[model samples]
Target: MQQTIEALRVALNKKRWHEARYALSRARALTNALPADVAVQEREQLSALRRMYAARNTPTAKKAQQAKSKAVGRAGGKKPAAKKSTAKSAAQTPKPAPVRDLGDRFINRANLGYGPTNEAKGSRTR
Candidate 1:
């Protein structure tokens, strides 16, 4: 039991989470073999050790490990050529003719005297 505890402490001091977890489990097993009171005391110590090691294995460290593996994967292979899509683009469809503007047509009608006339010489019935 003492040997396992010493191993766990050494592993923790070295900031080795995996080894610390292993030694902690071993220590826990050893404690279980001892008297109930002694086992309870060791269990508390084991729980503290678990928390300490868990805190050290931070999310940033996990992200860094993931990034390293991805980098290795990218470096280890030639990526296959990207496939060209067989679907035709909208550019292939003929565009509809532009709308004929009416403003110019209205101006042309006024100039040609085909639009509304002046009231001065207009003939009308009331």
Candidate 2:
């Protein structure tokens, strides 16, 4: 119960959607303490908490907004970028970072050898 509440609260603070939901689910599972009307309140509280946490991390958010602006600028779309401020951008969804695949190399030793001697070199019976 206490563990569930704490986990849920942390998730709420982090803007982690699943965590907040899990917390609410676990809280209900543990105690079912909330009134039907209070569920909406709980969600709003979580949203405010996430907003506050994001505001505190605005510098990082600003850097990302600037980078996105640069990308748009390079693309040179006729649809000019809106001059909306940083606060608005921060409230928007965070963009997924571009992924660079360095290669899918692996040392798969499981199917390397097959003979009795190979098995012997691998593991011994107790």
**TM-score against native, each model:** 0.39, 0.27
Candidate 2 lDDT, 41-123, residue by residue in tens: 55565455546444544797668767987775534457766885989888999999999996655433544654343354555
Best by TM-score: 1
Candidate 1, which segments miss by more than 4 Å at Cα?
59-126
Give the Cα-based TM-score of candidate 2 against the true structure: 0.27
- RMSD (CA, Å), candidate 2 to true, equals 21.4
Cα error, residue 122 of model 1, in Å, equals 99
Off by over 4 Å in 2: 33-126
Cα lDDT of candidate 2 equals: 0.62
Q: What's the CA error at residue 123 for candidate 1, in Å?
A: 99
**Model 1, TM vs. native:** 0.39
